[model samples]
Target: MFGPFRLTSPLSGGLLWKIPWRMSRPQKARQRARLRHVDKVVSIVDQALAKKGTTTAAVERWKAEMPVEQEMLPRDKYTIFDRKEKKYRKGIHKLPKWTRVSQRLNPPGY
Candidate 1:
């Protein structure tokens, strides 16, 4: 029953490749908003440092200005538990106290 069967060639056109899709407009906008907030915080910190002329005061002010709800957390909330040493130690210090003392001794270091 293969009478009058005709062979057809495959269609040729532009390449067809799968591409990864991207976020919708609303999702993109929300992401941009979050980035903007981060940028604002950075700018605020930078401006405070520049205007205060002293890192310690700027940091103290920043801490004082933080929301009270954040302050409710235990002082050692971020402290690391030294299992071997059996003590709670501060995690990486953002601005160690020694740095301030050293800067006082050598203002140029600041």
Candidate 2:
């Protein structure tokens, strides 16, 4: 045994373990409700898709609600073209005005 020469992660401070969590009543109810809603929606979609010859009204409505893809500008420098906003927006090119330790947290090469 290599005494004190331990292979452990610095991120875990040489110790790592799982903490068992008990879900409260509200949390359990919320998860169940979300899962039930998703299951219902999926089943409806499957039924609509199963009938081959004629397209169901629900399928047509869903297709109409689907969003269309938009064109995007090449992301090289600062500004990016926002598809939803229909505008060019600024990104990582803003001037920093941090004092003391705050200045160190700026993105790499900034």
Clashes of each: 0, 0
- Evaluated at residue 9, the lDDT of candidate 2 is 57
Model 2 off-target regions past 4 Å? 1-20, 53-110
The true-versus-predicted C-alpha distance at residue 87 of model 1, in Å, is 51
Best TM-score among the predictions, by candidate number: 1
Give lDDT for model 2. Answer: 0.37
| Range of the 10 consecutive residues with the lowest summed lDDT in candidate 1 | 101-110
Off by over 4 Å in 1: 1-20, 55-110
lDDT of 2 by residue, 44-104 (tens): 7757677655567765664464221111112212232333333333331222321111111
- Best candidate, lDDT: 1
Score each candidate by Cα lDDT: 0.38, 0.37
The alpha-carbon lDDT assigned to residue 52 of candidate 2 equals 59
Candidate 1 local lDDT, 15-41, one digit each (tens): 543322233456435534443454467
